[model samples]
Target: MLATIQKQQNNYVVKFTRPLSHSVDAVWAVLTENGKLQQWMSNLEMIDLQKNGKMHFNMNDGTDAFEEITITDYVYREVLEFDWGKDSVRFELTTTSDGSLLVLQETISELTNHTPKDLAGWHICLELLCDLLNGIVHDEFPMEQWRKWFVEYELLVEDVKND
Candidate 1:
């Protein structure tokens, strides 16, 4: 399944799930390593995939905007957990009848109100992942799509808050 944003538990959640023919090791390698991640995701550095390790992303303008990310839990080829600041996010992998199922859940913190931005970012990221797995090297930044989605998301959030 492609990544999507949902309202859950009074907060926003962004999730992606897919079944792949690749081995769990291969998937984990792509997700944990910096070079491999950049193949699909952004050019991110300072990512430590081990438990209690720190992970941060670099901005487009070469500035380091640090987030207090911690790898809270990890089990080889099975589960990975981390934090986006105080928010908890997890990646769970499971063996399915066909191949492997990968699920990513990003929980938004109540203190933050940037659900629209988060939704847009995740939509692009998941699209990139789909392209990467399919061996397509196309640029996956959906800037126009993100902007459109962000507007709708913000409107929805406002409607929910007022109800």
Candidate 2:
């Protein structure tokens, strides 16, 4: 499903919600554990997981350079929020009768041409994470799917701006 992008106060929030038929622990592992996280988000490595700790975002551009992302909030199996450049990305989990509901919200200080790209990238990542939890694995990142989502997010961003 496409994420809901809305302008809230001075910033924009792009939220993706997924209800998975897996335990909260399972989904939490996929979001934080290095092995499972790499399957979906290869560029991120959790260096220090506690609040005020750090995560490394590898450039992966052959220079071996990386940006240290700070963990702004942490609650075991419940919430994880971190700094994403100037913005912040948060993950919240809640248990349901069937399994769990995962909510990912990225707060953007300003909407730019690049905002849609980041939104689409995150859309793909969440989909990949859900698939992994369901025992589905893709050998490579699906660029085609990302491209499709990018166009949708572009339109959504425009609407938010017009509003």
Candidate 3:
């Protein structure tokens, strides 16, 4: 089972356990390389993989939406860190007895209305990544799941307002 979510410092930590039949290098390539990223993500561009390297991605939709991120730290096949505007995202990979344990820590500058949507999007993207890694063709996100989550998120917001 996946571990329960937790909040540490200014970031939310999500940890998952999976029996990845691939090597750590292979998994790292999928996460860092541009071609593999496009297979799972949408518009994608990456610079040299080094400290302060630049990474950019656009939403799949033709809305011209984009994110500019900077690599803060890089430890081959182990950990990667980046900054997206005011948010800092850290990706850590540990070799387990069976496979790899992946942990993502995302620190936001401030909690705002967009927090839930951002979290939901990341959750879906991570799932998509897993599917791609498992030899499944994941060219796009599952909109039905996104829609369901969005509706539930709206209801949560409404409930919060009433309280």
Candidate 4:
């Protein structure tokens, strides 16, 4: 499903919610554990994993690069928020009767042509994470999925601008 993007007082909020048939712990591993995280989002690596900790970042564009993204907040199996470049990304998990609800929110400081691309990336990442939790493994994110979502996000953001 496409994420909902809304403009706020100072920034834009893009949220993606997925109801998963997996325990919070199981899904949390995919969000935090290096092995599982690499499966979904390979650019991020949990370094310290605590509040004020760092998330090792790699451009993955062949510079053999290393950067640290500060962990703004952390609560095991509940909440994880971290600095993402100039903005931030957060994950919130809630238990449900079936499994759990994963809420991913990205704070956009300003809207740009790249807004849709960023939102689409999150959308794809969440879908891949859900698939992984359900025992469906994919060697990489399906580009077709990302391409489909990227266009949707672009239109959504354009509508916001028009309004």
lDDT per residue as tens, model 4, 2-61: 788788999988888999888999988999999999888888999899999999887788
What value of lDDT does candidate 2 attain over all alpha carbons?
Answer: 0.94
lDDT of 3 by residue, 60-101 (tens): 567877777789999888888888567777778877776676
Q: Tell me, what's the RMSD of every candidate?
A: 3.2, 0.9, 3.8, 1.1
Top of the candidates by lDDT: 2
Best-to-worst order by TM-score is 2, 4, 3, 1
Instruction: Give all TM-scores, in the order shown.
Output: 0.76, 0.97, 0.77, 0.95
Residue by residue across 1-163, what tens digits does model 1's lDDT show? 3355566677767676778876677777667777767776664543666788777665556665645567899887788787765677788888777667888888875624676677567656656766676677656576887787677767655655565
RMSD value for candidate 2: 0.9
User: Against the unseen true structure, what C-alpha lDDT does each candidate score?
Assistant: 0.69, 0.94, 0.68, 0.89
| TM-score of candidate 1 relative to the true fold | 0.76
* Per-residue lDDT over 119-142 for candidate 2, one digit per residue giving the tens place of the 0 to 100 score: 999999999998999899888999
Error of 1 at 28 (Å): 1.6
Please estimate how well model 4 matches the true structure, expressed as its whole-model Cα lDDT.
0.89
